[model samples]
Target: MMAPDVARVESAIEQAARRGDFDNLPGAGKPLDLPAAHDPDWWINQRLASGEIDSQALLPVVVLLRKEFERREETLAALPDERAVREYAEDFTQRVHQDRRANPFQRMLAPAWDPEDAVARWREVREPRPAPTAAPTPEPVAESRRRRWWPLRRRG
Candidate 1:
């Protein structure tokens, strides 16, 4: 009951298998976890998960810039000193400046990050945290701790 095209394709696959065309290929033995529905980024995500591509290398310039912006505070925290944080922030913002798109349509793929604002935000993240202060003591409750119970109602 198989369609002619399906039968033809099956015959072709059998022939290829006999010729060892599918042997020794990468991930040949491993089963792929394909989704039931179509996914545009599935391959890219798989490549990242399999270590075939680095996160930074796989990410687009615009995406990378956005990721940098999102991780700005964490990056600053990881730096040994404020100067290092400032340098990183400056470089990140500069790169973002280089990739900015002027056209409104094209701008969707290349986001603009203001270098000055990035630097300022970095400075804020790098500032020393204030010393912890004791929390104010709670005031005692003023309501009476009375318990009330309803007596069984007399048969109406």
Candidate 2:
């Protein structure tokens, strides 16, 4: 009763499972937690994970702009000198402006990405992310339900 495509996909998955492809794989038994709605960045994340897609080649000018800025920031961080950093910052700003001008959606362009803030953005990207701190301890368990945040007046 299975559709051809579905059966083929199931067979492939079963074959992979039999070949030990699932053995010791991280989160093997866990459910897939997908986003509730379609996510724009999810496609790019999947492309990057596969190693087959060149980030630079991916489309939609805004996405390219974001990725380009990130790449530029990484390159600048490694060899940042005042002159080089200043030049790249200026060039990056110019490129962002060009992208905005070329974008078909004039509304999406207006005040969407302020190229003027590129230098500040660059500084943020170059900064290392702070380490994850331990989670704050939960509040002590209350002895009675009546003492909870909202005191309930239970009529006897």
How much lDDT does each candidate structure score? 0.72, 0.68
Clashes of 2: 0
Q: After superposition, how far is residue 49 of candidate 2 from its true place, in Å?
A: 12
Instruction: List model 2 lDDT by residue over 1-156, tens digit each.
Output: 999999999999999999998899877889765557888787567658779787667566667666666576566566455556667666666776787777756554312334345456656767789999999998877677535577788899
14, model 1: CA deviation in Å?
A: 22
What are the models' TM-scores? Answer: 0.46, 0.34
> Against the hidden true structure, what lDDT does model 1 obtain?
0.72
Best by TM-score: 1
